[model samples]
Target: MTEIKQPIEMDITEVVKATGLASSAIRYYEKKGLIHSIGRKGLKRVYHRDVLMRLALISLAQQAHFSLDEIAQLSVNQKVPEINRNMVHSKIEEIDTKISELIQLRD
Candidate 1:
């Protein structure tokens, strides 16, 4: 049987183009330990394709108002993050509460 090899690394420009994120945001995510780069490819950071999924998760969490620290707690220098279900539920409840408060204020 023959095995097929897949590309594992992507250039920073590819990532930025795919994710619609700026280079600075990618660098910020790297600095925050949310993602990892295997090496530099001519001044461009190279990352595993897994970074796309990680960045997507980070964006969703941020949209939900999850702090960078909170996201970091879920992921850090790890290929797969350990997500806390309880924490997600708590955040949901918090958002629901805030929405209710806002509705009351508007009425």
Candidate 2:
């Protein structure tokens, strides 16, 4: 018989390793309601494996200059993160305008 191994729940250290984020950052996200942990493991927060993906999306949004509040609006805690198309479109337009301004200055 073959053994199946899986870590359905991960402690904060594991999440930090997988996401390259500091433990403090993870806790901050939880405090901000951007992500949640299932429970605690000996003082360490244990999160569902899905939280790795949520953190990834949060990182992506941050890189794109979205505020934490804006990312929260996406309902990051949900299994499938919800995107507000109108908000996304607005951001795209904002980016386009900034690019145009930068190009004008460069020229």
Candidate 3:
């Protein structure tokens, strides 16, 4: 008989190395419905590879100053949600305003 291998999974440690996000942050994201662990490997949470992409998107959105609430709205079911164009335009306008303010301060 041949031995069978289990499906690929990333434990919390692997995720931390891959994402550079603290374990707490990953758990928080899961708590906020931003991402989910596929299951667990013993005491460790296990997730599929796709979660790395979701984590990347979350980090980018945070850097862009999107609130957690906004991020939640922008992601659904572990994927980018259908966006409301007006909301996206509004965020852009907000960034533009910030840029203008920063330029004025620098002048």
Candidate 4:
């Protein structure tokens, strides 16, 4: 009795609305390996609902001071089961260190 999750699909325009990213930006993410489109709805790129989460991760990673290359590596595929948890922890620690240093300077 293994449970399987169904994928929710959306056209590019809908994805744009959901992610607040322009079509070009979405295409760029797909090109950069951070996100991927499952297929085409006519001429529009179709993406799975999980793309929203991936986009959110990309945003968070940027705020965490991760480079595009690092983000791309971390978000290599639409299914991110291969992402290393240790690397994410390391980045969080790095952010924490920076925040602590800033606090020390402020105080």
For each candidate, C-alpha RMSD in Å? 2.6, 1.3, 4.0, 4.4
Weakest ten-residue segment in model 2 by summed lDDT:
73-82
27: Cα error in model 2, Å: 0.6
Q: Report the CA-based lDDT of candidate 1 relative to the real structure.
A: 0.89
Best by lDDT: 2
Error of 4 at 64 (Å): 2.6
Q: Each prediction's Cα lDDT score?
A: 0.89, 0.91, 0.85, 0.83
Clashing pairs in 4: none
Q: What would the per-residue lDDT of candidate 1 be over residues 1-107, giving only the tens digit for each residue?
A: 99988678999999998899999999998998889899998888999988999999999899999998888877634676778888889999999999999999999
Tens digits of lDDT, candidate 2, 47-86:
9998999999999999888889989887766788789888
Instruction: TM-score each candidate.
Output: 0.88, 0.93, 0.84, 0.73
Of candidate 4, the 10-residue stretch with the lowest lDDT total is: 75-84
Give the C-alpha lDDT of model 3.
Answer: 0.85
Candidate numbers, best TM-score first, in rank order: 2, 1, 3, 4
lDDT tens per residue, model 4, 18-60: 8888999899888987788999978999998988888888888
| Residues 1-107 of candidate 3: C-alpha lDDT, one tens digit per residue | 99887446899899999899999999999999888998998999999877888888888878879887898887543455566677778899999999999999999
**Candidate 1 residue-wise lDDT at 55:** 91
Off by over 4 Å in 4: 1-7
Which candidate comes out best when scored by TM-score?
Answer: 2
